[model samples]
Target chain A: MTNIAEKLNISEKLIATLELEKNSLAGTAHIQAIRKTALGSFTEQGLPHRKNEEYKYSPVSALFKSELCPAKQNACAKLTKSTIAELRIPGLDSHLITVVNGFVSEDLSDYNPNAKSVLVYNTRNTAKHAPALFEKHFGQYASNDADAFIALNTAAFQDVLFIQIADNVQVDKPVVILNVTTTETASLASPRNLIHVGQNASVQIIELYVSIDQNASAINNSVSEIVIETGAKALFYKIQDDCPGLNLITTTQASQKANSHFDTHTVTLSGSWIRNNLNILLEGEHCESHLNGLFILNDSQHVDNHTLVDHAKPHCESNQLYKGLLDDKSSGVFNGKIFVRRDAQKTNAYQSSKNMLLSDDAAINAKPQLEIYADDVKCSHGSSTGQIDEEALFYLKSRGIGSESAKALLMLAFTQDVVNTIRIDALRKHAETLIEKRLSK
Target chain B: MLSIKNLKAGIADKEILKGFNLEVKAGEVHAIMGPNGSGKSTLASVLAGREDYAVTEGAVQFNGKDLLDLSPEDRAREGLFLAFQYPVEIPGVSNINFLKTAIAEIRKYRGLPPMEAKDFLKLVKEKQALVELQVTLANRSVNEGFSGGEKKRNEIFQMAVLEPCLAILDETDSGLDIDALRIVANGVNKLRSENRSFVVITHYQRLLEYIVPDFVHVMYDGKIVKSGPKELALELEAKGYDWIKKELGDVIEA
Candidate 1:
């Protein structure tokens, strides 16, 4: 750790841990050069403080201020195929990849590795297996220059789940990356994932975070970079239903080429403290993007969702809708930023953030920022925050529905629009079930 | 079947219904005709256990039970229905789903098992046909994007399905055209029976021409000033409410 960054409150314990991991990490010379550059950035710019606008609502760096990072540790013992079988989420008909802690445990996963439509590699082996491809896209879009967490994450790792879709071949099933964290102590996990879709190929990716034990204390600093080629389409779903003891800061960045369609739905069900940074860049013309998110929180849980849609090309359209239902003392934040470049004329952008604070103590902060240099563009944004509609609740109760059920119906209705944006029927049903389970409680 | 004694209710600090009293027996339809701001809607809201209205000095009894003690859903379970003047539009909740849930809950409260799917569908079909409601409309979100006539007709359709014993129509005829008023009155007329009663509150006597009321009461300044037979409606319609207000004016002051 550099002396200047120490003034930024980066813990001394964290600095020592990173330096130890930096010496022990093994990678190719080219990948090492990338890590060295990331380490240099991390040394210069430490963890973010409250002064940073992005980290204003969430003090995620506070978790690392006192204790060593948990990403590289927390290897669960006795996680055999039989022991981990109970951790698998059933009923998802997709190619599954299970990453226990930060390691891709093949014994606990179910996927066909020999499939010609795609190539999948674990992080530890990617440096030796797909050195050329890994050197090109890994760390390209999710630049760690400004983000301290990304800088530290890009430098420290045990494994990176790498997936590459072949050109002109449509994958038959979605690739499900299920991150299961199990540790005895308060562990930290950093799972860096990279996905690249070739030209004319279409694929679906579902990243699920789960904790085997609800009482296990852990924090995950995860980042995934996706690059979509021309004429390709992709559907990405990020579902966070971890335990209360597990906190998370996950960043997903994607860049799309010409004529490509990308849709992402982020559903945060349960967690301790979660901060999600989702950024998408329309690098080519005629690209379309849909960003939808739904988060239902209770107790003292906190979740901050920040998204960016950069329309760098002409004729690109994007729509964002994020809805949060907060009960008890839980708090939530939604910050959406849209940037339309000077040449990106004919761009259409719409954003809306709606929140329902069930309790008076519960709070929400919603911000919609738009910057457009183009003259001929249509952009609109609005935000609404309030309690459940008492009139609607009374209307339901007058029809013989109980108060709890009435509230549930209204709450479910509030999240219906964003939930309906999910294209996959089964996944949508799964999301509905997850939301229903929370509301019913 | 339903009785309100000295019902004085209001929203916030201002009391709207000063001293109201009414009783409706089974096999009878009571038409409460009054001008605007006469506490007609307050009586409806209070009867339905709306939390906004506080019943400061009154006792409402429904089927031998203290109605004020029950919750809104309990009042509904006790066979009390209020067709709102401005029906609320709740989006995302399908109309049919809402009805099914209401029916299931009401049935459960009555110690009855869940209704068979076929029977529920049949009941829905029958009630929809009675109100001339489209199947698509019945299956859409509850009263969402519904016209004035359709919303009124939907209230009657729900009343028919739930079979409420004492139904309160709070200005259900305020914004309806002639054809819509006819259809709504037709639906209500079909649902009337010897065991069911209705409190049809309206500002216009034109609605009574279709479904004649057994008793007509004129409400003024939160009190029932006059009570008479159904002809009283025609008399009030012919000679405006000024005559009654003038006569009752002396009595009110004294």
Candidate 2:
């Protein structure tokens, strides 16, 4: 990644810009070496185009324009807590961790800086302070072989937000990583994050992406690698709402050990464009994983979610439910894959993708794939896309509920099963408010 | 008070209700008895402002207001209720929440504030007992996974809660057994008041046996062929629909 190639093989504008960002890479020598390998992979595969197998519906390359570059260092320096406070949904009591354009903004964050049970720092600093731990798992989980975007992020990311929980530490307060990408110009922010939960430790991490300065557009290609140790429990929360000029691509990879529990929820109420790739690897026995997602889009917004659950060990269970409610000309896609290894006997995996379209022009594509090499495993997947039930709507309206409230209610019901899986109570309430607002629009 | 004059309705070019007419004052329970395909349900659908049914020529005056001028929700807010023949099963909307929202919207329309939570729960409990609904069913999704009898009882329960002035029970007795029918009819009878009226549309006379109607009209080919007292339902039930067809033929020739 450090050495720039004289000639480029692909004509993608983002890939060309990535090649030019060779000398500006940050972190330690170890990360620089890994960045080299990742850059090589990205340069070889290039940006995902229209015909790319993974991006058939979401042509990620088309979003890249020559005007879009890495945002400057002092992009949101004028942003204050009061201005960002207006965007907050009420009733959230958590230790706030704010990151502006991938850089940790301490003055904007509210967490304890001297907490002994947990440590939160940018990876560049962590790479110097906690060198051993950083080298062990920094670039280990997120694969670059197939996904060019992940490699592109890894090769060009300047800073990484790192969080580590000590063994047997039960952090009561959730850490809200509020990321605001100021898009006064066409800008791009590739944020790299790593969360390591120690043995028997439990925590919740909420990654919220919101946009400001909407005169121009921005793209945030973020990658977060989570390591849940033995007997640990984690809840990964992602909420995207009221993002007017943000195009987001996120890949979250979680590796669980024996007797670990990992639950992830992704809710997208408003965004210009969004794509989420969640990959869970259950390597040890008796692991449990639950993935729930809800995306309610209108206007011309788009959101694509691709999830993969790999059951490599026996006695593991995983359940996934993703639902979408689309209106106007908005579109969405859901692709879920479950793979059960041969030795993973008694594995139980279930996935369902349910979508409802309020308008005839709105569309959705749902695909569920399951592969089981073990005979004793129980795995099933169901995908369904439908319009709002006319009978149900009439039934509601006939009861004195107006059209707007009725549609919002019905859309909330369609997403209730998935939204209910949100573990945080206040966060769940905030999500309901956000979802209802989006639906009513 | 309710009045329907020269109501003609259909579904996408296929006319069903041709020159239908009816009139009922306040507190009058009108029973519309008709055979299958006689446009009985179409009349109920059109009255409730269902978008599928287009009224090409007609006027419905309810409480001195043009009913056709209001949306279905506004009609409900104006004290019109339609108990569907086959109630829709909404999977994720709890019966209690649905009721609360309906009451809130209706109250809002009437220039009143929302009911307090304590009062709302109290009202729910009272309404549940009217239809013998279990306490658990109030928390469950609206009519979801409910038995046939339970669904009908839920409709009556909803009708009890809303307390509509003009309640249209469209074939509410079609799928009820004797015990369930008695329970549901008992709920409706308890809700009947001097200020509230009902139009019970049914094929059988068994329901009329419980909640006797003020008037029974024999409908044939989208028009009332015979109008008489409540005994007319018993006559039609015994002689079947052929008697009405023959009676209409004689009138047409005259």
Candidate 3:
């Protein structure tokens, strides 16, 4: 195995090094056990290459060249006041959690401690303490058979977040998780998060990613695993507005039980290269899942979205819609797949991907597919990629709109379909403002 | 105030309008009645500066300016408006927002300040009432999911908002019921002023009965073969365009 690791290329070498380095954590038995199990799985599977079906569009080989060490736990290394001020949304100052370089900082977070049903633990050290609880749930859902990146992420789980909501508890305030990356050197960082919602519990979680420095070419490989127990509901929103020099790979895997509902919205605005994988597994009957995303790429940015909805039980419903606006030399890729097992009868699934190319040089590759093995199911998939309507443009121009303002108006209208899907009013307004700013530029 | 002399236009290499001539004065409603493929829409598109229609020869003068030299947007700012037969459906852009932008843009072109939001909303309400458009429909995306009558009324509403010096309604009466025709015609009548002119392009005489053009022209084979008073429309409706074809057939044989 060592000889095979040495013979492999740069990405393989990085994976091998990460697998070997997991043993040197010198943490408690639980952390060690989890790391060893993940490393073993990674060693058996290795990193995914271009030949892998799931990662055919996103290549992660370039991320392995840089060496990234686990961030040190420093209480004084908190986010600045200016940075916190800039991270303020319209109505999101009450419940916020700021994580800098994978570690949660107390000064930057505003979560109230008096909430009886909500519990927030910095599992970076908790995993070392509670070995049984950590081992029981960690790395149990994401498989390493097809995705090498997920395997590598499991193998190198550094700082982990564990959020638990008690049974039937409803949190009125939304939770905002701000992930800020400020690195001057070439490095890799993985921020692992796990969310558990008990029976009949409901919550809203917002994740924001921003870069502090522009010169550093950092690699962000993060994973968020969520479990919605029976009759639970979870709404997850992720906003990726990182600097153009960063490379990002994020995976969100969610599991729902009977009568549960889960909704995830991902908005990608800026990144040199980004790949997002979202998977919703309906493990019980009468489960509902909604996946919505919007990506606006300019210049030479590349954004790819690969999503899957697995209906394992009967009477499950899923809806997915992703839209992309590509300008300049940017490129976009969207591949959404829905699967219904043989026994998952009465399944209703709908998926659509629409893309608009602003320039002739910009390109988009969209594929929305469905695989249904059940006889009593309603499933449909559609994809369309085209330029803006010339007649519409002429209509606006003939109404005295200038070329730029006309383009901006049309682009804003194009993105409204996806923005209207947001159920949260504040978040929807914020997304609209960000989209307007990008289109104006 | 508008003159098109020896105007020849076409899409690609196939010419549609050959040596067409027309003159429209201020405050006059001139209706161009033609059969299919007679280039009625082409003349309106050319006047409104649609780039798809290439003018091979001749020129169009609008209010002493070279209309052919301006882009569609510039021509629009110069007080030229085309009420399309098939108004575009722009999803996500509310009708109020679209109209405000259009009005603001035209005002800016004329060296005026932006309108106050309160004043603009007031104007929207007024014009919307003039067209009998529902307030709910005005708040939605532009012409999205609108009925045929609603779309035509929305076009008239926009024409009223912009208050263009020259308005061309191209087949505005097509696909309209009698009730819709009355509402649309009433809206046009309310917007009629001595300072503004209109060119109503239609195929049937039914629309002419309501809008009541001052002059009516019979266009065949891309050129106007005869011109007369408003009664000509009634005559053409009775004769059914074959009279002009036979009259030209004898000329060609001679």
TM-score leader? 1
True contacts kept of 3: 0.89
List model 2 lDDT by residue over B1-254, tens digit each. Answer: 89999999899999999898999888989999999999999999998989998989989999999999999999999999999999999998988889999999999999998899999988889899989988486558989999889898888989988989999999999888999999999999998889999999999999999999999998878878789999998888788999878876787899
* Pairs in clash, predicted candidate 3: none
CA-lDDT, candidates in order: 0.85, 0.86, 0.83
- Best of the two (2, 3) by lDDT: 2
Prediction 2: B-chain TM-score: 0.98
Residue-level lDDT tens digits of model 1 in A312-384: 9999999999999999999999999999999999999999999999999899999999999999999999999
Top of the candidates by DockQ? 1
| DockQ per candidate | 0.89, 0.87, 0.84
* Model 2 alpha-carbon miss at residue B113, Å: 3.8
Residues A54-140 of candidate 2 have per-residue lDDT tens digits of 899887644664346675557565689887677565777788888777667777888886798788877655566754666799889
- Top candidate when judged by lDDT against the true structure: 2
Clashing pairs in 1: A70-A188, A71-A188, A71-A189, A123-A160
Task: Indicate whether candidate 1 or candidate 3 has the larger lDDT.
Answer: 1
lDDT string, candidate 3, B1-254, tens digits: 89989899999998989888889999999999989999999888888778898899998899999999998999999999999989999998898888888989899999999999999988888988999988575569999999988999999999998999899999999889999999999999888889889999999999988898899998887788889999999999999998889888999999
lDDT of 3 by residue, A373-427 (tens): 9999999889988888888999999999998999999989988878888777888
